[model samples]
Target: MDTPLKNLAIIGAGAMGSGIAALFASKGLNIVLIDPMEGALERALKTIDRQLNVYAPGGVQEAMQRIQVSPGLEAACNSDLVIEAVPENLELKRGIFAKLDSLCPARTLFATNTSGLSINAIASAVVRRDRFVGTHFFTPADVIPLVEVVRNDDTSEDTVARVMATLRFAGKRPVLVRQDIPGFIANRIQHALAREAISLLEKGVASAEDIDEVVKWSLGIRLALSGPLEQRDMNGIDVHYAIASYLYKDLENRTEPSELLKSKVESGQIGAKNGQGFYTWSPERRERVLREKSAALGELAAWLNGKAGGS
Candidate 1:
């Protein structure tokens, strides 16, 4: 039998790291959150505290008590699992993995919360490549249920199984990604849709708001319940094939980022983080949208959980 994962060490105290730490800690697992930057630990703890107060009010103190913040990498030495959520630079990740490889025990499982980096290359930095895997959690990790568990060529079966079990125990829906492909599963599909959306905008086919409305009412609503392939099967494979045959030739297949997006970035209108992008976002508008999205996701998460339980 495999050993149960009791303690986790997250090696970044940014949004993703803190969110992940809060998630495991709330599930009764001990977490050590480490970052070398000044005030990072305090900021992360504040964020975790605020999120817990909003979502799990009764368990805020208990969860907070389970997390220990440290400014050194050595704090992760005794952890059962170590997850690196650093910035998306290849060399930076490699450096961190090398340090972690030397500091952590041989039995410790190492996972990277990398979005699109090569898992094989990252695993190569560590001595125990077989114990290294990828655990890609979405933004607002505590709220999102989906986690892409990516296994590379050298990742052992035991490593995958243990990581999957731990994620499931933490109330996450972990999907194993067999290959170390760019963007993994979700982001690949998401970017395909985004590319087409931007293509339409660039060609003046429709306003961004109208396109968004169409997607939300049409594709988004259905996808909330059933996945694309499953929906395609229900709609009839023959019909899907016929539509694909006709539409495939005309679909957007650009290898480069859309000029519209580039221009937006050049002009410093880089979406909600700033003030505008494809759409203008005032501070109030951004807050309102975030609140609405959070509430909707919360409701959807509850519904999905209930559905899974019934099954």
Candidate 2:
């Protein structure tokens, strides 16, 4: 039997890394959060404190105490599991893993929080390929419940099982990907929807506001309760099949990104960061929306947990 996970480490003190650390620490795991960049660790601690206040108010002090900030990978040499949550750069991640492979023991399992990078490619940097897996956590990791535990060709069943168990212990719902596909599961579907949404917007079929409203009021509510496949079953697979038979051809099938998105990037209208994209977001609006969204997500997560417990 595999040893139980206790000591965890997260490389990078960015938003995702800090969130992941806070999440595990809340569950009583000792986390060593490492970031070499000056002030990054401090920022991460503040972020983690805010998150723990929201997620584990009664135990904020205990949870905060569980996380130890560090400036180098050496501090994480003793960790049972080390998760790389750095930026989505293949070469950078590979270098980090190579260093970790040299410092850590053979028993230490490695995981990457890469959104869609090839698991096999990332694992190639280390000799313990069988112990490497992908633990793709969505943005706001502390709130999101779904985590894709991706298995590359070299990843062992034991590695996958242990990672899944660890994520479950931290209050996350882990799904085994089995295959190392680009974008994993949720991201691929999300991009497909974006393609269609952008295509419709470009064609003047509907205004951006209305298109977003339709998805928010309809699919958003429905998807929270039932996934796409389950909803298709509920609606009679034949009906969905019939719709797809015709609608499939009409849907966007562009192999590349939509021209509208490309043009926007060229024009420096890269959404919230720039104050404009599909919609204009002033600094105040961006701040307010993020704060509101975080609060709402926390409430929703609590409600979902309650529902899951009752069921």
Best by lDDT: 2
- Clashing residue pairs found in predicted model 2: none
Instruction: Report the lDDT tens digits of candidate 2 across residue range 154-256.
Output: 9998888898888888878899998999999999999999999999999999999999999999998878877899899999999998999999999899998
Q: What would the per-residue lDDT of candidate 1 be over residues 192-219, giving only the tens digit for each residue?
A: 9999999998999999999999999999
Q: Residue 175 in candidate 2 has what lDDT?
A: 92
Worst 10 residues of 2 by lDDT: 302-311
Screening candidate 1 with a backbone cut-off below 3 angstroms (N, C-alpha, C), the clashing residue pairs are none
User: Candidate 1 lDDT (Cα, whole model)?
Assistant: 0.90
Judge candidate 1 at residue 53 and give its lDDT: 74
- Compute the lDDT of residue 195 as modeled in candidate 2: 92
Where's the lowest-lDDT run of ten residues in candidate 1? 302-311
Q: What TM-score goes with each of the models?
A: 0.96, 0.95
On the 0 to 100 scale, the lDDT of residue 29 in model 1 is 94
| Superposed Cα deviation of residue 172, candidate 2 (Å) | 0.7
Give lDDT: candidate 1, residue 129. 93
